[model samples]
Target: MRTTHPHPTNAVEPPIAGTAEARRVSPNAGWWRVIGTVLGIMLLLVAYYWVHKPLDLSLVLRLGGLLLDLAVNIALFVAGGALGRALLASLNWAVVSRGERIAFEALAGLGVISTGALLAGMAGLFRGVFLWLIVAVAFLIAMRRGGGSWLVDARAFTRALRPIDRWARLWGIVACALLAMALARALAPPFAWDALNYHLVGPARYLSEGRIVPAPDNFYLGFPQLLELLFGVAMSAFGRDTVAAPLHFGFGVLGLILVAGLVRRHTDVRAGWLAVALPLSATSFWLLFGWPYVDLAVFAYGAAVLVAAVNWREHRETGWLVVAGVALGFGAGTKYTAGLLAIGLAAMIVVEARSRALRPLLLAGGVA
Candidate 1:
């Protein structure tokens, strides 16, 4: 005779006490509390501002314009990311991790956009219409080339993510706050010395003259101007220098993402958060956090080079080497000091690929 079962075949087991699942609060109450606290603080800040100085129509109108400009700068970045995704897809690369894919696409896309702008500026196509046309064309091409599929993949990845532990959430909040402060500074008018001297000056002059003209007085203009070219794109498209700081801030954000990504790939999630926190907390990093300077761009592309190089080492994929080379090229373009990165990367390749290393080094070098 068959015996009756104590529980159904699909019966759920209660979480064991002291285990992670058991420790999790029901309905994510912790998140609600965090959200409430943030909202309360925001409301208080607004009330204080209102009490100190009444909001005027002119102030509201000015804020609206700033918002509009910010939106335009972000839209340009999104277009570049889409275009970069298309370019990567064309390469037939098959990155499995969503984080990796996002990082690579953003870096590659921005590099492509910046490089195109540089070429266009050199060819005297730095006018508003041409800059806007480049952005439009990139957007159209990205849409044509599997943009929908990429979006679906991204959505699925986010939906499938596991709930973060409390420590992770705390660190995440810190990171966000830091980046938010940097962004607030970026949205303000740029006053950084280097920015006024050559960074913005070069872009302003280029926009006025409608090309990349020689600047004999400003020797800094002679440096590889990959970052300045991006500034020109923003200034030309939006008619404001404020957008340029945010654009540079974007590279700083990318640097954070890359630091986290590289660490997470090699180690674990906890380590990744630590990596992000460590650099972001540095006084040196904060010094240029939202400045319209090329330092962040150099940091970003240099990080990309390492990410691609490490990925190539692990997976032995030829495409990753090309990616590394491209990143190095962009990094070098952003600042000549990236030649130092190239040296470090070359040594790394040789040390890691001890046997038959010539081909790999040659490939990355040729691409760079």
Candidate 2:
């Protein structure tokens, strides 16, 4: 009765101190978010201006050709990837994620396409029209052989993607910046030291001769030229040496993709992004993307071998072993240094064999 004199015992209390102020902070937080977004946009604009000052008519004209060259270059890769898919359709890919499988297909396709180009160049069939016809044939074969399934699978994978966490976001940003810079550098005229000395020189000579000829004076020509022949294909298709730079960039980008996929297969998605950023963070590797060099090709083919070998180890399927062997062969064909990878991979196969079996060793050694 005494408590009820002023108010009921169970009555609601008054609002707590500072409650209104805390409620007001939500709108302020939203305003800050808006400000941050606007500032980020402005920063990006400033960076663009800093990089490309006084963009002139001549620059604009060159941009059109650049776009065309890039388109043709990408088209060739896509066609090659389709052919690769067709070639690998029989393999059991249950061990890998779809993204990883696509990467494998792309790497394989590049090997196949380059090998075809090398053969064509050897036969004096490296003309622009013939290259275009080869691209057409690859596309036709792919469409006839269940090509739509890959597109569907890719779409499913895209739909399944969710926003990455903070760490992955950071790494993704760095990877994108490095890739963009590499592309810009590739667009510039060829002035890299090694590129001028032999990389571009060999392909230029091969294209001019209309066949693969022995270049005794340039000792580098005697080395494996798997990637150089692809450069020749690009140059012949586009009628410019500049096209090869972008092609090199493409190889580097694919190498990063293979790396990311392999890491994701072994660990988690975030680690995959980290793997991509880590390799690209190196100045030399990033710069190699802009030069008409085979380093990136070796990196890509080597990654392919690793991924295929891992798949084989998990599934114990000879097809995956064959895939790994093919990748190793292509890598060795790109550069002599890649033979080191073959040695390492051969040892790995021997160590992994059942009771140290001789069959696996023989198959791997012969393939390598």
TM-score (all chains, Cα) for each model: 0.81, 0.80
Candidate 2 lDDT tens digits, 286-310: 8898887889888888888888888
How far residue 313's Cα lies from its native spot in candidate 1, in Å, is 0.8
Q: How many backbone clashes can be found in candidate 1?
A: 0
- What are the candidates' C-alpha RMSDs? 16.9, 11.7
Rate residue 109 of model 2 by lDDT. Answer: 76
Worst 10 residues of 2 by lDDT: 154-163
In model 2, the runs with Cα more than 4 Å from the true position are 1-57, 148-163, 354-356
Model-by-model lDDT, in order?
A: 0.80, 0.79
Error of 2 at 293 (Å): 0.9
